[model samples]
Target: MIGARLDAVSEIAESMQTHRTSHASVLEMEGADVTSSQTEIHHIIVSVLSTIGRSPDIQRGLTRIFHRKATAAEFIAVIQAILIAAKQLQQLCIIEDKSTNQQRETLHSVLLRKLISIASSSTVINGAAKLLSALNKEAADRQDLHNLFIISDGKFPEVAEGTRRVELANEKLDSLIVVHRKQLRIHKLEYTSVAGITHLIELPLNTKVPPDWVKVNSTKKAIRYHSPEVLVALDELALANEQLTVVCQATWNSFLTGFGGYFAEFQAVVQALASLDCLNSLAILSRNKNYVRPLFVEDDEAVQIHICSGRHPVLEAVLQDNFVPNDTDLHAEREYCQIVTGPNMGGKSCYIRQVALIALMAQVGSFVPAISAKLHVLDGIYTRMGASDSIQQGRSTFLEELSEASDILKKCSANSLVILDELGRGTSTHDGVAIAYATLQYLLEHKKCMVLFVSHYPEIVSIKNKFPGSVGPYHVSYLTSQRDVNGDFKSNEKMDHISSEDITYLYKLAPGVSGRSFGFKVAQLAQLPVACIQRAIEIAAKLEAAVCNYTEQQIRRSCSLSHRQDGCKNEPTEDVLESDSLSSGRVEGLDDISELYRELFLNLNFGFLEEHGDDRRLQFLMQARNLAAQLIKLWSSGKSTTRDLWVGHTSWFEL
Candidate 1:
């Protein structure tokens, strides 16, 4: 009966044709495939109402108010009447069905079972066991009266206080369980030809069976064997069941008629949920004082990200069970990509992910974890920091990293923010350096997106020199001291335990480069082999010396070539003489700017120098020396005015 009602609903839904939004259309398409599940509840309603029709009093009452015709409208009116009656009985809804394998039956059936159990304990009727006997006789004698009864007393059930029947119904519904089974069946088949060959064909439905069966059976035993009230309650339930059948039958026809109008809309909504295209379904959560996104003004200027004390909402939630989250600040005007360098487990990954999450919140149109936020909408956000690899896809970890990075490069625009963590670690040192360098250059020079790069490679620090003032470094602080294990000389381990005051995790943008990678302390914390760590340190020392030696060799060769040119006959004698005088009188070999310039251009003829160049460079150099002398004189004279003589101007060019 339930299956027939569902089929009818499916037909009605299929016949519905109307224009729908993208979201709505998808929902309807999904619903059409499984309209049976939704219609079952409604069908139960029709069945209940049909059972109610067995009582002459209810029939008379309904007929007086509803049209006499057995049309769809009359069916709905009757269903509504039953619903109203149920509502007045303090029940929200009802559904009945066969029991699942091990789980109880549908929500309504469980509720009916509970009600029957409770009613049997009442002390109201006489010879209650005989009540079922009489009802079964009546039902057999008059088929229409099988489950019908009239509540001449109109008394409501009595049980616990403040517990509405509707509330109980909802509770039972909440516990409704569905189980799925995991099973696979394989089939072999032969091809069939249209004209010549007669072939075997195999069709597989892959028909699913319950993975885990949930059957519904009361934990309750019939305790009213000798109680009269139990019989009275059984009689009431029997009558209620009769009314239930009539209601369900009527509901089925009503659903068939009206379902055509609403089924399409309902289906579209379901499909939308399945595809996760509800766009507005995602939620944003944060706990910070700064905004995570760019804000746009009415005039169209964008609001920059100025997150202070900001953190990743997901990370924070995870950490809440253990450690505290550090606060951070990211601003467009002051910071774009922050080169975060620190010891391992120093929170670099956490910081980068937090920024990405904040941006994600903004793109999806949600508030971020900050005190106050204004965001310019972003197109999309990309994150590439964590470890994920698929060997089945024929990609190594490094290859996968490069693939994701390449994809990001192709897709990210100026409005996107890219986060990279220890990129290029899957290759040789030189190759990794080259890749890291080129990747950063592309992000800065081409992509022009907001970026946060976390790396252990020190080579990236050279970027400050290449793109002066464009790059800045921030490091996590650790303790350092002067001590030796044997009390003879200073030990490197003294710097291992950095003081708390230094671990600002300050998240502040400051000038200068990160000090050093505290990998030793980190290794200690991780309990690495001490011998391996010492070997690594020894290798690192050798590598550093080799690099320095190579650099010095290049500088010495260049210096030799310059000196040979300096001693030529056409040399500027006066500038050379000045440099010699300064060198002779100065501390060590440090020369003032003018002296260095004189030494630099000693071979050039004075006439040629004047003809080819303006005096701005020469005058500026001379002025710099004069300012330095004045500063020294003031220090000796203990007078501030002596220094004031060269207040502003290009004097600001001092290193």
Candidate 2:
């Protein structure tokens, strides 16, 4: 029996390996667009069954299951029962895509039901249930029961159930009777008369079912009700010194049909699994690295890459009601760093983390939840953006931040992306600012790493001013004032309000810095005292004043320097020049006016007109008259018309 089991094991292994090899070939060609892993596993099971012969029992069961004769729930129960038997036989059962609704009837469910039903009925062989019932009891004085039928999947049912079944059996004759699968020892108890006992069933397979067979001695007495031919066959087989008996063609056929049905199911599953692009490829080259640079090619240089508006897949699934999608833009000019500032509950952390996770997912060969993207390739991503402590490692939250930040700074290169949120917040304000300042300078001067840093400190905004065009500052905007006619501010005070329900975030990214932290407001909303809010405001005011003073001093110094280098001048001066008469002749009314002016000047010279004043005065009067003539001419031909190019009219202003 052990040798037979070994042979079966070898056969199963070889079969699995062959199926796996073929699956690998298919997967290598499928690439990233493959179906999921569960689908692939289902495919493999179907394929394997196709290679093997289908059993008739399995066919019958499948026919019953598929035609809706059996409900899916009942079918699952039946399949579980067969698995229970096979377990007693030391067989393996792997069901993939079991819980899916797509396929109404699975092969394993169909096959197992048939086997269990057949094994329970009698052509000549005793039913496994009936046999176990008889064997579990003992005949105290008589030696009557002799025959045994053991059917098992090789696992044992729980002891409590088995004990109950044992107590239920009526056959008597034992100091010892049942052989427990777990203990591998026979149970010895008081014996009852075994004069009428003839059949035994042992179900040592699954933890649910009873033993399928019982040991029968040749010296035991036989009853007249036993079949003569079965007794003769057993005697002959027993004479041959064989520990295990062979099943006849009829029984073997039944098993093949039943088991083959399950095999077909297993094959279907395997084939389905193999059809998935990822799993198939994995089957072929299981050693390959898990890195995939997505096909997000940037079409236009000017288009800002929006990792569109997307939710983190894992986070979204977990936070079904509370999940809010965030957007990211990677513009070429704002390449390296993006400093994001926002009030509390504005989703700054979620935005940064979602972007990092999306990038990671893209590289890991999964579809990203984005409307569209033109992503640049990133080799690695480092994040020091969240707070967590490792007390076991004797590390505090600040220590963890320092460790993560140091690692990020040391390892990040031009292609790596880094995200740090409130980097120095766990420490003193001055120390945090100093560390953040030094970190920014190091990233700017030493490495061209892409960074998205979220912070409340206004000092990071100075990076945008000092390193012009290197950093882009984005502040999440909020409506400043909200009030009703009663002069009370509207607050999101309801504690029962979930993150998703009635939550409104402006979500727009604006330029410049946010003015205040609403920490005290949030505390008040959480039922804190008004004095606490006042104290918070006072502290905030002092900080704001200090920052304003520094900025003012810096502004004054720069303005004074600019003022020295002819920098007080605001507008350009233009020089006056005499007009060219020939150039001016093209004017419509001015042409006639110029001719009239010349005539007047000549008439004055020839004494055809009376001079109203001295010669110099006459010349000045003529010039004034010429100007008036020009003005009158201009008035006469005022507002020259304009025609479109389609009308084919050329104008003085035509290009």
Candidate 3:
């Protein structure tokens, strides 16, 4: 297989050769003629092939042709024929070495490389392409089966000369029969089932028969007979014709097999043609996709990848013009690790995959789908991208994820390209965040390779401050706007309510942290139940409020732990409550109300901030605030004061 892009090989040769070598100089060889025109030489070859009578003739004709000037077309033609034969014989050669079980170079591979090298030369490119086209046309037409060097235009000289003698004898016998016509009667000529046996079916009535005549078949009215001398002549004719036919067949088979001796030449030609074909295919792809030949720096230590306006090759092929292109810059100095956070439908996976593909394509010596690309040589590309479980192997999604990640860390080097998406997503939130952080840290501090880490965990992005320049924080841009909003509503109700078209994904990668993944929006996109979407929206709002309040410390409360007798330790002392109650004239205002119920709040888990009642409830609503506000309203009904409420709730701590 001419697997390497032949254009790259051509370029390499061009760089080394500097000035182009002329076609005449390249075609003119040590043992070949330097004077004859290619057309004349081709005619000479066709003549030699036509005259081939036996294996010896095939050998001599081919040797003579080889001594003549070898044009690129003629050379490629013979090589093409050899390739056709090699395909049948390829099974005879081992594809790989058994001892090492690795790809072992064989004589087959060597000859193939030589052929490709020859075909890629400036002298042969045009001539060989045209020659190959003609040869293929011949194959399609089934007209060019001249590989055996057998001359097919006319009968062989040996067959013709021998058959001529037999025909001449038969003609003389017929003449004798005509001469003897005055004396002998006419007869019907016929043949028997026996080989070369002829007979006279009958003679004319009352005809005079020769004295040496012998009757073979007798009819009722006439006798069938031949002269003894004529029979002898007929026998000789049969022998002569039989010998001639036998010789012709043997010579024909031998002539065709004669080319088998020149397998080496045929193999070289086939290899060259295959390489040229591979180059043509890659050229077409490059042209159609607007691909650019990536630039490579000579410095091996300067490992990096810089792409301008790079598009996903497969996506561009499919979506064409509509696939958005993006830019990437990953270097050894900084931006070594990119933590890409975005909404579900954003192009994070696409972006990372494009970079890796471009790297692979560069290594394969093909142009990449980018306006400009400067890349370092990568040893290999490692990816843990999607959620693929190994059911047959008994590996769950998380287990598969861990296994792939482990292997990447185990084998990847500084020159490798690593793309990881949503690492550790199959575990608990805290554990997943921790594992993701650890994985990124391992790559950054140890591997230091070009990495694209995609994650949804906002807690994971905290590492940006830890690695600063080495780790980048980026997300796909999106828009968040209020739908059908009235400014007159209070802060609480507006904050809790979510409306349609509340989130619009931009799909553009922007620097800094993304606020959220918009899970509810993605759920809606997935066509999840409407009730499910509404519930998710409500929980998300509550969680957001809880997180905001936690960050601002706006609502602090006391806890009345009902689990134990000493649970109310977090509550304010009796003396302090009494002092505040006396300092404030009416009832104590609800400031620092969180401290009043500190024990109860302390028992609440972060998960409780989600959906408080049912259905994996995740809400940002402050339940503690509502309870406090209700309690204050109840007491201010002129029935009880703040101090009296706390005293009365003393029994609530009795677990």
Candidate 4:
């Protein structure tokens, strides 16, 4: 129940923030300055409704009504307040009849007028009247319903009779108090009530002398007693009060029961109020932030999104003037997929999010945080971002990431806008790249949606080759110093590694792919141990060199094979001989240990051992022991490097 209420409130808030202000009449307003009228309307809305929006009481009441948890009193109060505001807004919209010229109605005025009409409708008026008539006039006036039912014989005879009896009982109690005061000869003596026991008289301990009086309690200074007449009155009062409570409860239940007929009407009023609230909110946001209205393409047009100088609405608010704005352009007939690559913390995610947010704000009819925007209305916005594992569901982080990606693939269409950030980063690099690649291919070739993809994997950028003109590569531009002339680290060292001090984030999107993610800089910024960083750099460099060597070898071998196929029967070239010599040297270096392992495994006849029993098995075991001893001895002497020994070999036990 609480979740449902919260969801309703959230929906209301979102609607208010993004409610579009466009109307045909406003769009077609002639001889009137539309922008100025809009500004004036925003000012009026802010002035009229800002206080109500900030009132927690009003907001809570509205939320209750929205969720149908409100009592008649609560519903009446909230509707009364909204109606009062609507009237005030209506008066503001009214132009004097004395004016010679008529004023053209603006969009804001039209919306305000619509709100007033809804508030003043017969349904709302009759419902309010019925509720007020059923409630006590004084309680209704004060907007308090602690005593809900009207104590009138005409409206609720049972409640009225119960009330009369309670009143008469109270009068009888008062009469007894007067009699007791006169008899005690103490005019100031009054009834002392404690813990709901009413009409007990207190007197001096020595002065009490009535046998008919019942002793209630006594202290040193005073003795308390209830006269016989007072006890009878008290009992009548208690019974009358109880009866009144039961009657009042029944009346209140009946009142609510009758209200069910007006539930749909009141619900409509609540919806109108919600719309009014959102309109007012949107006006305020647009006026304060100088947001521009976005122009949406017609349904017949091709899908497109073009934003000029767009800024992230949230980040801009937080960053103020420091937030940098960037442009976005995508079209189904042109570059529909943007592969965004940049260093960590370079604002890649922020840029994509900005684009998505602007699109969403535009579609929802809210002014976007941009200088200008023109886009086809996206049918849906799909995003797969961040990383999380569902432990309770027994799913790993990679599984969750892929699951979201899979859902996106299944659901997204050509008219949708998709944002994927580092789609497959929760697993191995090769697998991550493969999954990310396949996902992008599916989106481009099949879904053909407008995609803003962020990835650290450089290899995924190659998808542009298969989908030419539709895929565009971009990077969040940044500046770096303390690098070689080629804009990289020294050739012998890691090419992408850079100290945090040497890099500066520009936070602007630009063309072309980023060479590296500059993750080491991020690690440095995170304050990882210096020695650990250096060791990582060393390991990274070795891996990079090994990969480069393997690639070069493969290319050369392919080239040689091509040349041989072309009927060249000449001596091997220097490059070929060098490659052969390099390859043969490693093999020759590990030949001794390799031969020992070959003899130890290949010479053992398993079938003969089983038939000959322990005698033949004993000989094979002795040979295996000698081979293991020789292998350990060779390794200890470091006759060959471990890399060379393992380069072309599997396990030593393999025959």
TM-score of each model, in listed order: 0.43, 0.42, 0.55, 0.69
Root-mean-square deviation of each candidate, in angstroms?
Answer: 26.2, 26.7, 15.5, 13.5
lDDT (CA) per prediction: 0.44, 0.47, 0.59, 0.69
TM-score of 3: 0.55
C-alpha positional error of residue 30 in candidate 4 after TM-score superposition, expressed in Å: 15
TM-score top scorer: 4
Please provide, for model 3 over 1-655, each residue's C-alpha lDDT reduced to its tens digit, 9 standing for 90 to 100: 1234534433333322322335466457552222222222223222322332211322233344355433323444453443333332332223454556776322223433354344334333333333344333433235332221232346355655665777887786776565455454434343232233464435655766766888776657867676776687778777877776676555544533543454344335445445434444455567556677777766555789999988888988888877878888999987888889887878889889998998888777778899999888788899998888989989899999999999999999998899999999999976787788889888988999999999887656657767888888888887766544453333322334564546666766778766457677778778999998888788877877876665333223222212334544543333322333323332234445344455234323332322222221121123333444545655565644555755665643321
List where candidate 2 sits over 4 angstroms from the true fold.
Answer: 1-242, 245-295, 298-305, 311-327, 331-334, 482-485, 488-504, 529-531, 538-655
Candidate 1 displacement at residue 302 in angstroms: 3.9
| Candidate 3 wrong stretches, greater than 4 Å | 1-117, 120-261, 485-499, 538-655
Q: Candidate 4: which stretches are off by over 4 Å?
A: 1-44, 47-80, 90-96, 100-112, 120-126, 133-153, 172-197, 200-229, 483-501, 542-655
| Residue-level error in angstroms, candidate 1, position 124 | 41
Per TM-score, what order, best first?
Answer: 4, 3, 1, 2
Candidate 4 overall lDDT versus native: 0.69
Give the Å error, residue 317, model 4.
1.8
Q: In angstroms, how far off is 513's CA in candidate 2?
A: 2.1
- Candidate ranking under lDDT, highest first, comes to 4, 3, 2, 1
What TM value does model 2 have?
0.42
Q: List the residue pairs that clash in candidate 4.
A: 16-278
